[model samples]
Target chain A: MTTLHVIAHSPFGDQRLASCLRLLGADDGLLLCGDATYALKAGSEPLQMLQAANLGPRLFALAEDLQARALDGTQVIAVDYPAFVELSLHYDKVNSWL
Target chain B: MKFAIAVFSPAHAPSSRRALRFAEAVLASGHDIARLFFYQDGVHSASANIVAPQDELDVAAQWRTFITEHSLDAVVCIAAALRRGVLDDTEANRYQRPAVNLPAPWELSGLGQLHEAAQLADRLVCFGGD
Candidate 1:
Protein backbone atom coordinates (compact mmCIF):
# COMPACT_ATOMS: atom_id res chain seq x y z
CA MET A 1 0.00 0.00 0.00
CA THR A 2 1.16 3.49 -0.86
CA THR A 3 0.30 6.73 0.89
CA LEU A 4 0.14 10.12 -0.79
CA HIS A 5 0.75 13.15 1.36
CA VAL A 6 -1.25 16.18 0.30
CA ILE A 7 0.13 19.44 1.68
CA ALA A 8 -2.60 22.03 1.26
CA HIS A 9 -1.91 25.68 2.10
CA SER A 10 -3.92 27.47 -0.49
CA PRO A 11 -7.32 29.04 0.04
CA PHE A 12 -10.31 26.70 0.34
CA GLY A 13 -11.87 28.88 -2.30
CA ASP A 14 -9.40 27.20 -4.56
CA GLN A 15 -10.89 23.84 -5.53
CA ARG A 16 -7.76 22.44 -7.07
CA LEU A 17 -6.78 20.54 -3.97
CA ALA A 18 -10.28 19.18 -3.54
CA SER A 19 -10.26 18.03 -7.11
CA CYS A 20 -6.99 16.26 -6.49
CA LEU A 21 -8.55 14.51 -3.52
CA ARG A 22 -11.45 13.28 -5.62
CA LEU A 23 -9.06 11.99 -8.22
CA LEU A 24 -7.10 10.05 -5.64
CA GLY A 25 -10.35 8.35 -4.57
CA ALA A 26 -12.91 8.73 -1.82
CA ASP A 27 -11.20 6.53 0.81
CA ASP A 28 -7.74 8.05 0.60
CA GLY A 29 -5.93 9.49 3.64
CA LEU A 30 -5.97 13.22 4.26
CA LEU A 31 -4.01 15.49 6.59
CA LEU A 32 -5.20 19.06 7.34
CA CYS A 33 -2.37 21.25 8.57
CA GLY A 34 -1.48 24.95 8.58
CA ASP A 35 -4.04 27.43 7.30
CA ALA A 36 -5.81 24.72 5.41
CA THR A 37 -8.16 24.44 8.35
CA TYR A 38 -9.04 28.08 7.90
CA ALA A 39 -9.95 27.38 4.34
CA LEU A 40 -12.20 24.61 5.52
CA LYS A 41 -13.66 26.86 8.15
CA ALA A 42 -14.26 29.65 5.71
CA GLY A 43 -15.96 27.32 3.33
CA SER A 44 -18.06 25.79 6.07
CA GLU A 45 -20.62 28.54 5.83
CA PRO A 46 -21.48 27.86 2.25
CA LEU A 47 -21.16 24.13 2.72
CA GLN A 48 -23.52 24.21 5.67
CA MET A 49 -25.90 26.41 3.78
CA LEU A 50 -25.84 23.98 0.94
CA GLN A 51 -26.47 21.09 3.26
CA ALA A 52 -29.28 22.89 5.02
CA ALA A 53 -30.82 23.89 1.73
CA ASN A 54 -30.80 20.26 0.69
CA LEU A 55 -28.37 20.96 -2.10
CA GLY A 56 -25.65 18.52 -1.08
CA PRO A 57 -23.24 17.59 1.72
CA ARG A 58 -20.19 17.63 -0.49
CA LEU A 59 -17.60 19.44 1.63
CA PHE A 60 -19.20 18.50 4.92
CA ALA A 61 -19.29 14.87 3.97
CA LEU A 62 -15.70 15.06 2.88
CA ALA A 63 -14.64 16.42 6.24
CA GLU A 64 -16.62 13.79 8.10
CA ASP A 65 -15.12 11.11 5.93
CA LEU A 66 -11.61 12.37 6.54
CA GLN A 67 -12.25 12.57 10.25
CA ALA A 68 -13.41 9.00 10.31
CA ARG A 69 -10.29 7.87 8.54
CA ALA A 70 -8.14 9.80 10.97
CA LEU A 71 -9.75 8.14 13.98
CA ASP A 72 -9.09 4.79 12.38
CA GLY A 73 -5.29 5.15 12.74
CA THR A 74 -4.79 6.78 9.37
CA GLN A 75 -3.03 9.75 10.99
CA VAL A 76 -4.11 13.22 9.93
CA ILE A 77 -1.70 15.48 11.76
CA ALA A 78 -1.92 19.26 11.62
CA VAL A 79 0.73 21.63 12.93
CA ASP A 80 2.28 25.02 12.19
CA TYR A 81 5.64 26.00 10.73
CA PRO A 82 7.52 26.22 14.03
CA ALA A 83 6.48 22.68 14.90
CA PHE A 84 7.50 21.58 11.43
CA VAL A 85 10.90 23.19 11.95
CA GLU A 86 11.36 21.33 15.20
CA LEU A 87 10.37 18.07 13.57
CA SER A 88 12.60 18.77 10.60
CA LEU A 89 15.51 19.24 12.96
CA HIS A 90 14.89 15.67 14.08
CA TYR A 91 15.42 13.78 10.82
CA ASP A 92 15.33 10.42 12.52
CA LYS A 93 11.69 10.91 13.43
CA VAL A 94 10.63 11.40 9.83
CA ASN A 95 12.87 8.59 8.61
CA SER A 96 11.52 5.96 10.95
CA TRP A 97 7.76 6.45 10.75
CA LEU A 98 5.12 7.58 8.22
CA MET B 1 -1.23 2.11 -4.19
CA LYS B 2 1.82 4.26 -4.82
CA PHE B 3 1.29 7.98 -4.86
CA ALA B 4 3.17 11.26 -5.10
CA ILE B 5 2.11 14.59 -3.69
CA ALA B 6 3.05 18.00 -5.08
CA VAL B 7 2.63 21.02 -2.83
CA PHE B 8 2.55 24.61 -4.11
CA SER B 9 1.29 26.73 -1.25
CA PRO B 10 2.82 29.21 1.15
CA ALA B 11 3.63 27.94 4.61
CA HIS B 12 0.98 29.77 6.61
CA ALA B 13 -2.17 28.80 4.76
CA PRO B 14 -4.87 26.19 5.26
CA SER B 15 -4.25 24.66 1.87
CA SER B 16 -0.87 23.32 2.92
CA ARG B 17 -2.35 21.82 6.04
CA ARG B 18 -5.09 20.18 4.06
CA ALA B 19 -2.44 18.72 1.78
CA LEU B 20 -0.69 17.09 4.71
CA ARG B 21 -3.99 15.72 5.94
CA PHE B 22 -4.56 14.19 2.56
CA ALA B 23 -1.14 12.57 2.73
CA GLU B 24 -1.87 11.09 6.11
CA ALA B 25 -5.21 9.82 4.88
CA VAL B 26 -3.46 8.18 1.96
CA LEU B 27 -1.19 6.35 4.33
CA ALA B 28 -4.11 5.31 6.48
CA SER B 29 -5.70 3.77 3.45
CA GLY B 30 -2.69 1.48 3.19
CA HIS B 31 -0.94 3.23 0.37
CA ASP B 32 2.74 3.94 -0.14
CA ILE B 33 3.86 7.50 -0.66
CA ALA B 34 6.45 7.70 -3.39
CA ARG B 35 7.61 11.26 -2.82
CA LEU B 36 6.55 14.69 -1.71
CA PHE B 37 7.70 17.50 -3.99
CA PHE B 38 7.51 21.06 -2.72
CA TYR B 39 7.44 23.68 -5.43
CA GLN B 40 6.97 27.40 -5.86
CA ASP B 41 5.73 28.99 -2.65
CA GLY B 42 5.54 25.62 -1.01
CA VAL B 43 9.25 25.77 -0.30
CA HIS B 44 8.58 28.26 2.46
CA SER B 45 7.11 25.44 4.49
CA ALA B 46 10.64 24.16 4.99
CA SER B 47 11.96 27.48 6.27
CA ALA B 48 13.25 27.29 9.86
CA ASN B 49 12.29 30.73 11.09
CA ILE B 50 8.59 30.20 10.58
CA VAL B 51 7.00 30.50 13.98
CA ALA B 52 3.42 29.77 14.83
CA PRO B 53 1.52 31.89 17.29
CA GLN B 54 1.17 30.58 20.83
CA ASP B 55 -2.55 29.96 20.33
CA GLU B 56 -2.59 29.06 16.67
CA LEU B 57 -1.75 25.71 15.10
CA ASP B 58 1.63 25.07 13.57
CA VAL B 59 1.22 23.21 10.29
CA ALA B 60 4.84 23.19 9.18
CA ALA B 61 5.84 21.32 12.28
CA GLN B 62 3.15 18.77 11.51
CA TRP B 63 4.65 18.27 8.06
CA ARG B 64 8.08 17.71 9.56
CA THR B 65 6.65 15.15 11.94
CA PHE B 66 4.64 13.47 9.21
CA ILE B 67 7.67 13.23 6.95
CA THR B 68 9.80 11.85 9.75
CA GLU B 69 7.22 9.40 11.00
CA HIS B 70 6.43 8.12 7.56
CA SER B 71 9.91 8.31 6.11
CA LEU B 72 8.40 10.34 3.31
CA ASP B 73 10.82 11.52 0.63
CA ALA B 74 10.48 15.29 0.74
CA VAL B 75 12.11 17.34 -2.01
CA VAL B 76 11.89 21.09 -2.31
CA CYS B 77 12.30 22.81 -5.63
CA ILE B 78 15.77 24.33 -5.60
CA ALA B 79 14.88 27.28 -7.79
CA ALA B 80 11.81 28.08 -5.75
CA ALA B 81 13.54 27.67 -2.39
CA LEU B 82 16.50 29.79 -3.45
CA ARG B 83 14.30 32.50 -4.87
CA ARG B 84 12.30 32.52 -1.65
CA GLY B 85 15.45 32.54 0.59
CA VAL B 86 14.93 28.94 1.71
CA LEU B 87 18.57 27.94 1.75
CA ASP B 88 19.83 24.48 2.56
CA ASP B 89 23.36 24.00 3.93
CA THR B 90 24.90 23.90 0.46
CA GLU B 91 22.90 26.88 -0.65
CA ALA B 92 23.82 28.80 2.47
CA ASN B 93 27.50 28.10 1.83
CA ARG B 94 27.15 28.87 -1.86
CA TYR B 95 25.69 32.25 -1.09
CA GLN B 96 28.03 32.72 1.86
CA ARG B 97 25.11 33.08 4.18
CA PRO B 98 25.94 33.14 7.89
CA ALA B 99 23.70 30.20 8.73
CA VAL B 100 21.61 27.51 7.09
CA ASN B 101 18.02 27.53 8.18
CA LEU B 102 16.20 25.20 5.81
CA PRO B 103 15.88 22.17 8.05
CA ALA B 104 16.36 18.46 7.53
CA PRO B 105 13.79 15.90 6.29
CA TRP B 106 13.45 18.25 3.38
CA GLU B 107 15.97 18.26 0.52
CA LEU B 108 16.72 20.95 -2.01
CA SER B 109 16.39 19.49 -5.47
CA GLY B 110 15.24 20.15 -9.04
CA LEU B 111 11.90 19.73 -10.77
CA GLY B 112 13.26 16.48 -12.06
CA GLN B 113 12.31 15.06 -8.72
CA LEU B 114 8.72 16.01 -9.48
CA HIS B 115 8.88 14.19 -12.75
CA GLU B 116 10.36 11.17 -11.08
CA ALA B 117 7.55 11.20 -8.56
CA ALA B 118 4.91 11.44 -11.26
CA GLN B 119 6.41 8.50 -13.10
CA LEU B 120 6.97 6.39 -10.02
CA ALA B 121 3.71 6.83 -8.16
CA ASP B 122 0.46 5.32 -9.21
CA ARG B 123 -1.11 8.71 -8.65
CA LEU B 124 0.51 12.14 -8.60
CA VAL B 125 -1.65 14.19 -6.27
CA CYS B 126 -1.09 17.95 -6.49
CA PHE B 127 -2.29 20.31 -3.83
CA GLY B 128 -2.75 24.11 -4.08
CA GLY B 129 -3.26 26.19 -7.16
CA ASP B 130 -1.05 27.09 -10.11
Candidate 2:
Protein backbone atom coordinates (compact mmCIF):
# COMPACT_ATOMS: atom_id res chain seq x y z
CA MET A 1 0.00 0.00 0.00
CA THR A 2 1.19 3.50 -0.77
CA THR A 3 1.91 5.66 2.28
CA LEU A 4 1.59 9.42 2.60
CA HIS A 5 4.41 10.43 4.93
CA VAL A 6 3.22 13.55 6.73
CA ILE A 7 6.03 15.46 8.41
CA ALA A 8 5.29 18.44 10.64
CA HIS A 9 8.68 18.91 12.32
CA SER A 10 11.56 20.97 11.06
CA PRO A 11 14.10 18.99 9.05
CA PHE A 12 16.93 20.63 11.05
CA GLY A 13 15.51 19.18 14.24
CA ASP A 14 16.08 15.50 13.46
CA GLN A 15 16.34 12.76 10.91
CA ARG A 16 12.61 12.38 10.27
CA LEU A 17 12.74 13.71 6.73
CA ALA A 18 15.89 11.80 5.95
CA SER A 19 14.56 8.59 7.47
CA CYS A 20 11.24 9.03 5.69
CA LEU A 21 13.04 9.45 2.40
CA ARG A 22 15.21 6.41 3.06
CA LEU A 23 12.21 4.19 3.72
CA LEU A 24 9.89 5.80 1.20
CA GLY A 25 8.50 3.32 -1.31
CA ALA A 26 8.59 3.93 -5.00
CA ASP A 27 5.02 5.22 -4.95
CA ASP A 28 5.02 6.83 -1.52
CA GLY A 29 4.47 10.59 -1.11
CA LEU A 30 5.74 13.28 1.28
CA LEU A 31 3.64 16.10 2.67
CA LEU A 32 5.36 18.88 4.61
CA CYS A 33 3.42 21.16 6.95
CA GLY A 34 3.87 23.15 10.16
CA ASP A 35 7.51 23.75 10.95
CA ALA A 36 8.47 21.20 8.32
CA THR A 37 7.72 23.83 5.69
CA TYR A 38 10.92 25.55 6.81
CA ALA A 39 12.75 23.00 4.72
CA LEU A 40 11.61 24.85 1.63
CA LYS A 41 13.48 28.00 2.62
CA ALA A 42 15.65 29.14 -0.24
CA GLY A 43 19.27 27.95 -0.10
CA SER A 44 18.65 25.81 2.98
CA GLU A 45 20.41 22.48 3.23
CA PRO A 46 17.06 20.78 3.61
CA LEU A 47 15.92 22.28 0.32
CA GLN A 48 19.04 20.94 -1.32
CA MET A 49 18.34 17.52 0.12
CA LEU A 50 14.80 17.56 -1.20
CA GLN A 51 16.01 18.77 -4.58
CA ALA A 52 18.53 15.94 -4.73
CA ALA A 53 15.81 13.41 -4.02
CA ASN A 54 14.14 14.26 -7.31
CA LEU A 55 10.69 13.72 -5.75
CA GLY A 56 9.21 15.64 -8.70
CA PRO A 57 5.45 15.74 -8.22
CA ARG A 58 5.34 13.41 -5.24
CA LEU A 59 6.15 16.13 -2.73
CA PHE A 60 3.51 18.37 -1.14
CA ALA A 61 3.34 21.22 1.35
CA LEU A 62 0.46 22.83 3.17
CA ALA A 63 -0.32 26.10 1.41
CA GLU A 64 -1.38 27.94 4.54
CA ASP A 65 1.82 27.02 6.30
CA LEU A 66 3.90 27.94 3.28
CA GLN A 67 2.25 31.32 3.11
CA ALA A 68 2.62 31.85 6.84
CA ARG A 69 6.32 31.09 6.65
CA ALA A 70 6.77 32.90 3.34
CA LEU A 71 8.04 29.73 1.65
CA ASP A 72 7.68 30.27 -2.08
CA GLY A 73 9.64 29.52 -5.25
CA THR A 74 9.61 25.77 -4.62
CA GLN A 75 8.15 23.16 -6.95
CA VAL A 76 5.87 21.54 -4.37
CA ILE A 77 2.23 20.68 -4.79
CA ALA A 78 0.53 23.01 -2.30
CA VAL A 79 -2.58 21.52 -0.65
CA ASP A 80 -5.35 23.24 1.21
CA TYR A 81 -7.43 21.69 3.98
CA PRO A 82 -9.91 20.17 1.54
CA ALA A 83 -7.12 18.99 -0.70
CA PHE A 84 -5.40 17.48 2.34
CA VAL A 85 -8.52 15.46 3.05
CA GLU A 86 -8.59 14.31 -0.56
CA LEU A 87 -4.93 13.36 -0.57
CA SER A 88 -5.22 11.24 2.56
CA LEU A 89 -8.03 9.28 0.96
CA HIS A 90 -6.15 8.97 -2.31
CA TYR A 91 -3.36 7.17 -0.47
CA ASP A 92 -3.64 3.80 1.20
CA LYS A 93 -2.26 5.13 4.49
CA VAL A 94 -0.83 8.23 6.20
CA ASN A 95 2.20 7.80 8.44
CA SER A 96 2.79 10.92 10.44
CA TRP A 97 6.37 11.35 11.64
CA LEU A 98 5.61 12.77 15.00
CA MET B 1 -12.58 4.65 3.48
CA LYS B 2 -12.24 4.39 7.24
CA PHE B 3 -9.54 6.13 9.26
CA ALA B 4 -7.89 5.34 12.58
CA ILE B 5 -6.56 8.63 13.91
CA ALA B 6 -3.87 8.58 16.57
CA VAL B 7 -3.18 11.83 18.43
CA PHE B 8 0.11 12.27 20.24
CA SER B 9 -0.12 15.99 20.96
CA PRO B 10 -1.31 17.75 24.06
CA ALA B 11 -4.63 19.59 24.24
CA HIS B 12 -2.96 23.01 23.98
CA ALA B 13 -0.80 22.07 21.01
CA PRO B 14 -1.42 23.18 17.44
CA SER B 15 -1.37 19.60 16.18
CA SER B 16 -4.29 18.74 18.45
CA ARG B 17 -6.40 21.41 16.75
CA ARG B 18 -5.28 20.26 13.33
CA ALA B 19 -6.24 16.67 14.11
CA LEU B 20 -9.71 17.76 15.17
CA ARG B 21 -10.19 19.72 11.97
CA PHE B 22 -9.03 16.73 9.97
CA ALA B 23 -11.48 14.48 11.74
CA GLU B 24 -14.30 16.87 11.02
CA ALA B 25 -13.29 17.04 7.38
CA VAL B 26 -13.09 13.27 7.19
CA LEU B 27 -16.72 12.87 8.26
CA ALA B 28 -17.83 15.75 6.06
CA SER B 29 -16.20 13.99 3.12
CA GLY B 30 -18.24 10.85 3.73
CA HIS B 31 -15.41 8.97 5.40
CA ASP B 32 -15.71 6.98 8.60
CA ILE B 33 -13.48 7.12 11.68
CA ALA B 34 -12.83 3.74 13.23
CA ARG B 35 -11.28 5.19 16.36
CA LEU B 36 -9.63 8.26 17.92
CA PHE B 37 -6.65 7.02 19.91
CA PHE B 38 -5.14 9.53 22.33
CA TYR B 39 -1.63 8.63 23.37
CA GLN B 40 1.31 10.38 25.03
CA ASP B 41 0.37 13.97 25.80
CA GLY B 42 -2.68 13.59 23.61
CA VAL B 43 -4.39 11.89 26.55
CA HIS B 44 -4.93 15.38 27.98
CA SER B 45 -7.70 15.91 25.42
CA ALA B 46 -9.81 13.39 27.31
CA SER B 47 -9.38 15.16 30.64
CA ALA B 48 -12.65 16.72 31.68
CA ASN B 49 -10.94 19.17 34.01
CA ILE B 50 -9.16 20.99 31.20
CA VAL B 51 -10.11 24.66 30.99
CA ALA B 52 -8.58 26.86 28.39
CA PRO B 53 -8.12 30.60 28.80
CA GLN B 54 -11.08 32.76 27.80
CA ASP B 55 -9.26 34.08 24.75
CA GLU B 56 -7.69 30.82 23.53
CA LEU B 57 -9.59 28.04 21.87
CA ASP B 58 -10.35 24.99 23.96
CA VAL B 59 -9.32 22.08 21.78
CA ALA B 60 -10.30 19.49 24.36
CA ALA B 61 -13.83 20.83 24.54
CA GLN B 62 -14.06 20.95 20.79
CA TRP B 63 -12.90 17.34 20.58
CA ARG B 64 -15.45 16.23 23.15
CA THR B 65 -18.23 18.06 21.33
CA PHE B 66 -17.23 16.54 18.02
CA ILE B 67 -17.04 13.02 19.42
CA THR B 68 -20.41 13.37 21.14
CA GLU B 69 -22.08 14.87 18.07
CA HIS B 70 -21.04 11.91 15.98
CA SER B 71 -21.38 9.32 18.74
CA LEU B 72 -17.94 8.20 17.77
CA ASP B 73 -15.79 5.59 19.46
CA ALA B 74 -12.96 7.50 21.13
CA VAL B 75 -10.25 5.70 23.05
CA VAL B 76 -7.58 7.11 25.34
CA CYS B 77 -4.54 4.89 25.74
CA ILE B 78 -4.65 3.34 29.19
CA ALA B 79 -0.95 3.62 29.87
CA ALA B 80 -0.69 7.11 28.52
CA ALA B 81 -3.80 8.24 30.34
CA LEU B 82 -2.51 6.88 33.64
CA ARG B 83 0.83 8.54 33.12
CA ARG B 84 -0.86 11.82 32.36
CA GLY B 85 -3.34 11.50 35.27
CA VAL B 86 -6.44 11.28 33.11
CA LEU B 87 -8.70 8.69 34.71
CA ASP B 88 -12.20 7.33 34.42
CA ASP B 89 -14.14 6.17 37.46
CA THR B 90 -13.02 2.60 37.03
CA GLU B 91 -9.37 3.51 36.77
CA ALA B 92 -9.62 6.14 39.51
CA ASN B 93 -10.86 3.38 41.78
CA ARG B 94 -8.34 0.89 40.51
CA TYR B 95 -5.39 3.21 41.14
CA GLN B 96 -6.82 5.03 44.17
CA ARG B 97 -6.51 8.34 42.40
CA PRO B 98 -8.05 11.48 43.90
CA ALA B 99 -10.37 12.33 41.00
CA VAL B 100 -12.09 10.94 37.96
CA ASN B 101 -11.37 13.30 35.13
CA LEU B 102 -12.60 11.14 32.26
CA PRO B 103 -16.32 10.97 31.62
CA ALA B 104 -18.83 9.31 29.33
CA PRO B 105 -18.36 8.89 25.56
CA TRP B 106 -14.61 8.74 26.03
CA GLU B 107 -13.38 5.24 26.86
CA LEU B 108 -9.99 4.29 28.24
CA SER B 109 -8.45 1.25 26.58
CA GLY B 110 -5.09 -0.30 25.71
CA LEU B 111 -2.80 0.27 22.77
CA GLY B 112 -4.04 -3.00 21.32
CA GLN B 113 -7.29 -1.22 20.55
CA LEU B 114 -5.37 1.27 18.40
CA HIS B 115 -3.68 -1.60 16.58
CA GLU B 116 -7.04 -3.28 16.03
CA ALA B 117 -8.51 -0.07 14.65
CA ALA B 118 -5.55 0.32 12.34
CA GLN B 119 -5.96 -3.25 11.19
CA LEU B 120 -9.57 -2.62 10.25
CA ALA B 121 -9.12 0.90 8.87
CA ASP B 122 -7.97 1.85 5.40
CA ARG B 123 -5.76 4.57 6.85
CA LEU B 124 -4.02 5.21 10.18
CA VAL B 125 -3.29 8.92 10.60
CA CYS B 126 -1.34 10.32 13.52
CA PHE B 127 -0.85 13.92 14.71
CA GLY B 128 1.65 15.54 17.08
CA GLY B 129 4.51 14.12 19.08
CA ASP B 130 7.03 16.82 19.89
Per residue, candidate 2 scores C-alpha lDDT tens digits across A77-98 of 9987768888998888788988
Highest DockQ scorer: 2
* lDDT, model 2, position B24: 94
TM-score of each: 0.61, 0.93
Docking class of 1: incorrect
Q: Summarize candidate 2's per-residue lDDT along B59-125 as a digit string, tens digits.
A: 9999999999999999999999998899999999998989999998899999999999999898888
Q: Each candidate's DockQ score against the native complex?
A: 0.09, 0.63
Clashes of 1: 50
Identify the candidate with maximal TM-score.
2
lDDT of 2 at A13: 90
What is candidate 1's lDDT per residue for B1-130, written digit by digit as tens?
A: 6768788886676557756876887777567889999999899777777899988778888899999998889999999998888898899999998878687898999999999998897666566631
Question: Which 10 consecutive residues of model 1 chain A have the lowest summed lDDT?
Answer: A89-98
How well does candidate 2 score on lDDT at residue B14? 77
Worst 10 residues of 1 chain B by lDDT: B121-130
